[model samples]
Target: MTSTRATVDHYERLAASHDHNWTHSGVFLDWMTSQIVSAASIGATDRVADVGSGTGLFARHIADQVHPAQPILCVDTSRPMLTQIPTSPEPQPVVAPAEEMAEWVTAGGGAGTAGELDVILLKESVHTR
Candidate 1:
């Protein structure tokens, strides 16, 4: 039967091409980003988490809105997928299941921060929840 392990493994193999398949640089993505960012009301100071942030499809755009203030956490179960994001020096990527993200945040994976998330996005990861 298909399970979370199988899902994560699949993503690990697909990580490199996930962005391309998702048309990350295309118009539809741009519009989606705008809508999500607007709906989330993400600001420079908002602490955000892009759950199921495969290849950073949405996290990259969210970063532009939150950068230099605080990096948005790119939380995903697959290490390969998390690593695909072009994020650095910001502690942006956290390898964790979407459902357990709050524990990671509270346990100081994102230390020195409050035990709350300002914004959480699960656009393509709703299945995980």
Candidate 2:
């Protein structure tokens, strides 16, 4: 099993260059993002939480789908990696391991489980904790 500590440490080391290493051509990113957004049927009004939102590789692209006034919760364990995400399009960073994501969002994340977040995108960081 993959330890959560190991996963967080691994990502922490790669934080500085995470975006550069994962990013592809604009066309490719757009295409990929479109596929995910479409598959999820994300709408402008949907409350979205992007778990493991490393460098916002997908979060940034899905911004337009969620309302401009609202913010996408970018959850990641690595602070440096979250910092790498751009400010534009507006993402609120939540520093928490993937396993704790749900608790953070609903309990401490201030959104309240009122209706629950409409969408949660858990791309790439599904470690066995």
In terms of TM-score, the best-performing candidate is 1
Superposed by TM-score, candidate 2 places the C-alpha of residue 62 at a distance from the truth, in angstroms, of: 0.8
In terms of lDDT, model 1 sits at 0.72
Task: Provide the lDDT at 62 for model 1.
Answer: 61
Candidate 1: the clashing residue pairs are none
Please report the TM-score between candidate 2 and the true structure: 0.80
Candidate 2 stretches with Cα past 4 Å from truth are 1-6, 64-67, 105-115, 126-128
Question: How large an RMSD does model 1 have?
Answer: 3.0
Error in Å for residue 3 of model 1: 4.8
Model 2, 1-129: lDDT tens digits are 234777778878988888788557988888888898889998877778888787877888888544534677788777888998877656778777666776655564554323367789988765555
- Tell me the number of clashing residue pairs for each predicted model: 0, 0
Best by lDDT: 2
